[model samples]
Target: MSHGWSIARRLFLAHALFILVLAAFVGTASFVDARDRGYSETADRMLAVATAIADNPLVLEASRGADPSGSLQPYALRVAADADLDFITIMDTDRTRWTHPTTSEIGKEYIGAVGPALAGEPLTEVSTGTLGPSVRAVVPVTDEQGAVRALVAVGVTTSNVTIALNARLPAVLGLALALLAAGSIATWLLGRYLRRVTLGWGPEQLAQLFVYLDSVLHSVREGLVLVDPRGELVLYNDQAARLLGIPPRSPAGAAAGGAPLLADLDLPASLGELLQSGRPARDEIHPTGSRVLVVSQQPALASAAGRGKPAAMGSVATIRDHTDLQSLGNELQGMRTLSDALRAQTHEHSNRLHVLVSLMELGRIPEALEFATRDLELSQQLTDELVTSVDEPVIGALLMGKAAQAHELGIALTVEASGSLSDSGLLVQDLVTVLGNLMDNALDAAVSGEAPRTVDLRVSSTADALVIEVADSGPGVAAEAEEDVFRPGFSTKDPGAYGRGLGLALVRQTVARLGGSLVIGRHQGAVFTVTIPTHRSPEPTPAADQAQAPRA
Candidate 1:
């Protein structure tokens, strides 16, 4: 047979260990009990006969003197004859046999389980021999004065004990076999009962389990996915579907095999490597669309029984929507910037007010009036910018924030965006993604250049497309970085970096999805132009469910 993997081997070993432990316990207990019972029964009978002889007052008194020639010989003969026994012996306290039916045995020392009996208490035990285990007993003898004097002892060889034990041998063996059989049967019955309790429920439990699972799946705000060991998806949630732009329901189940519903979602290459290696991979899938998805993965631990064996294996993936989170973060930054601006303005205003009071006191009203007029002009400019925004709230707020940032950075921003886009067919959010990345890149390029840097921006729309163009006066694109500029994974920074930086690539993807085109070249500086068809709206996307085949 071929060697198996950890998971399969583990299952087999688990079952084997359980049986081994149970059998060992039962066998040990049985051996101990049978050994104890057999020894005790033999010993009990011998000790009783020995004690009866010790209890004889005549024998106790005679054993104390221990002169077998006069009293012991007669007593030993009388007892043996009366009990209808073969052998009998009486001893002094030192365990020397004083009376033996065989004259040679008299006055001989017999060592055995006789110490306690010689010390004035009756006792019994057994010792093993070449033939088998034997039983022996000792009983104390007392003098006429009631003082303990000697002991009475009796025993039989294993051969004799066996003749007596053979009568019960059938019953003993039968009981032992019954016990073993009962133990094995009991273990199996218990195992069956446990299985019934845990796995025998009908469809009611199955439905409830499914409902419970569904509730758990939906409760998780993050998209959760469970794949079989074969790397096929078995479970996926609503959030995962929505973030991937998958249909509400496909005729097939979630994560169906056919042309993956959101196949266009750029899965990281590292994830593929992880799957092959039985590891896990994760990264943020940033699509320049409505949302950013946080993809996470965890590899399933192989079942120990399948050690080094072919077995089912898979991983779990979670996708969380970070779009709202990004919006909240942006709002918080805006608030912080607003706070800083208010603090600075308030401090400056306080100083100016103090100066104005001093000037009025000094009758210098003209200088104070000039200061007030300048402040008024600045306020009016801010108000005009707010009213003449490029588009919706999210866009207008972002642009205003960027403008404030530029002013803080001492960088001049020449905003020349045209056309009323609030009513345009293009998603304002998608436009923001395209514009935001380009604007940020331009700003970064401008920062390292000479002082008083400027970024030229123009946004316009034609009858069939929405166009966005950005030109910066910084040093033109580096020759080396240009070729890989729009490549999917070719980033300007380190390869292992957390920032995927598919800004240009994301721009390309979003444009293509919207049935549009993009061009990049120099326009006296760095230039980027993107065009997307300006349809009224996209057609309602259909569900993408399809039947799936069983995993290999």
Candidate 2:
């Protein structure tokens, strides 16, 4: 009740009750006063009338004669009645009524007699009157020579004074009741509304509701994330929601989404791999989406907090479309097959041409000589295109391999390599996969181009790194497709010449595992440089190998 009521209603009711009480007091006071004043005035008028009758010698003489004069007796009776007199009497000095309006009743002794009036002193006093003890006023009547003769007492009833309050107090009471009722009702209503509005909520419930909502937002597959390197989610978005596969509602025993789903995509292993290499991954293709997602990751890092090693507290990976890489890989693979077939045809043709020339020198000269000039010119043109375009031997070795299985194909390969590789911390199979794809890509690009065919393969090493660069002589990739090139299945070359985007991207993947960087560039032609950073490896001592060789 205290909680619900308004301050205004409380104040109003308090003031109202006070006002009612004050009004009651004033009303009672006013009524009592009016009645008293009315009664007193009537009493004074009656006393005066009685005194006048006593003072008139004719009336006094008549009354003393036992009703002798009719005029004086009638005049006194009329004056006393009109003045609302309850009683009238005359008293002598010895405290006895000398004459009374009720003559038979007034001859007894009087207790409230005005004695001075019967002596030489004239007087007035309010006292009990003759008519059954009413409020009264007394006056002394004087003789013509200013001598006190007798006293007259007049009075009216006191009952009429209290009756005045009867007519007005009920209205005042009704108004007070109405005001109090209105105040009580208003206070009660406001309080009830407040109670009703706040009844259902509690502190614990509000906290739990917010927690549940937060869980819904952060439990998504597509990296529903927000966090500094500490892994807090500040504004994990809706795409993350879809990726994480969070359900709309999370009730008990609800489906996975509702229960707050957590998908583990080998994040621990992936993060370990990332930390080992202090480089961001770009054009990274992962099978995280319905279609493969090619992601370029950027880690906006904050300074170390709380410890000597500031951990990678802030990191988010963004995703783009990666579906086209597969197609590119397939196309490159097909071109590799075509290049192989051409290599086989070229070998067969060269062998036949040599056989014809040998037969002509053995005297089958007419037919052989006719085809010899054309064959020689064809070989010369192939050599000219092969040597002029590129400048690396690893690239040339790839071309030589392609040319073995391809015909009418000009190849150009280049290399700028220094320093030697000892024991590398990788599987031969993995290295083969990486280098094989790169060279295969070179073959496809070289065969697909016009006669000015070329491929550049560069592999190098610093004190702690192994870097490989491969380039081709095809028309350079479009500027817009540069970033798109590494996405799985994204291909800019003729589909006939290359596979889907498995080659360069796979190379990049293997490089990443080794904690290395791969750079792609356009030299005289397009080039790719794969850098592998290594730790200090023990070198083979010359003396030990020489000592071992002594047995041989």
Candidate 3:
């Protein structure tokens, strides 16, 4: 088994190692340069001293004498001692030494390169001679006519160069050590900063977190979009792209100057406005293409520990596909209405039965028979009227069921029909959604009002469109709020009601989906008018009838 270091430790270690290597390289170069400079300075001083000796008139005159060494020996020795030179040799142009540091080496041929000197050139170099390795310079001694008279050589031994280099080593090493320490400190500080930025998570932990967050964002059904405070898109999940009907990835040039703009996504105008507003919004239903999305938005906020105000960072929005849910809810509501109608019918039948029994007990057999016969005839008449007037079974059953409910609620419900409907393109579900919500709203409004409450429903069909108008005897919608009534979650009824406002919105959506138009009439009470286009077909089948039948 092997254990790995944390990210902070690994980063610190790598930085420290790099600094160490760099410091070593710099230190090595500095040391080599210092040694070379020391040697060069020593060689230049030797060359200058040798040139001065060669330029002396007395030395030049003596070098041309019968015994040059006899005159040059003392002068060379004194100069060598005073100038701290390891060796100084004066020689004739034949490369024969006239003076040397050791007397035994005098009069011997020079054991180093003297070719440049013989050609009357002055030069400096490090070379091995009778005195081990030394930095030496050779200068050609010239007479008054500039003719070469002799060669003068001076040098500092390798041992002296070593001493000089050693003198500067401590300071160079100290500087290198200081740099290493500073680098270590910097590396440690950088590591600490990175740790804080990462919230103390290592690379493995961060990777895991990223994978988990990505999975959750993609797996969830709701669409999620995050935008910066400047109305630029920051992050969005796959669901968002799917919901908006956009490509899975941002398009080329979608981001302006490396920051994505929300407007580039081509969202619905209402949704774009909401996202740009950066305000908290809840349950704002907006239509996009053929889908209806319920969007909720919240601002991302952050605050310092001692700060009095929170800073607005950005906004996050969740989009839910509510089209299917709303349709199913509309169907469920229709079933509930049918159930209420059946209950009312049952109550009415029980009341009639009690009346018949009471009449029989009173010993008025003829009156009892007449009463029973009259009640049965009236019920049959209403059924006949509904069956004869409305040809569409779904609409007919819905109206009959709503009439029964209204009767129980003490609201007079009236249904008037003028034409028949074909089942070709007329969806029963859509009709139920439209008519059920309208009648339910009308009944609720009329029954809650003063006496003589009434709801009038008029149905008429043309060769191209079906018209429905529902009017209720209640306080009409306020002028200012009429336009807002169709907006989701907008209701003038009880504020605590959760689902009261969605009915009218759903009705409007269904009408629009069928390429129909809904208008609110400026009448004594609230009047809603809807017109839906239709297509003709053959008579309804048994299956169609059964599908359209009310649950009761």
Q: In terms of lDDT, which candidate is strongest?
A: 3
Q: Among all windows of ten consecutive residues in candidate 2, which has the lowest summed lDDT?
A: 255-264
Tens digits of per-residue lDDT for model 3, 1-552? 112455777788889999999889878888999998999899889889988988898788898699988988998889888988899999978878999989998888988888888888899999999989999999998877888989999998999999999999988898788889999999999988776556556688777877786777778889988788888876677788888876664423333346558778777677899988888988887766557788999998765433458778799999999888777776677788789988988988899899889989999889989988998899999888877788888778877888778888888878888877644378777778888888888888887777789999888887788999999998877878876887766776774465667778778878877889998875658999999998867678999999999998
TM-score of each: 0.47, 0.34, 0.81
State candidate 1's TM-score.
0.47
Q: Can you rank all candidates by TM-score, best first?
A: 3, 1, 2
Runs in model 1 lying further than 4 Å from the true structure: 1-221, 227-231, 234-279, 288-290, 305-312, 330-358, 378-397, 431-433, 473-513, 522-525, 535-552
Which candidate should be chosen as best, given TM-score against the real structure? 3
How many steric clashes between backbone atoms does each model show?
A: 25, 52, 0
lDDT for model 1: 0.63
Which residue pairs of candidate 3 clash?
none
lDDT (C-alpha, whole model) for all candidates: 0.63, 0.55, 0.83
User: RMSD to native for every prediction?
Assistant: 21.0, 18.3, 6.3
The alpha-carbon deviation from the true structure for residue 500 of candidate 3, after best TM-score superposition, in angstroms, is: 3.0
Judge candidate 1 at residue 513 and give its lDDT: 72
In terms of TM-score, how similar is model 2 to the real structure?
Answer: 0.34
lDDT of 2 at 28: 64
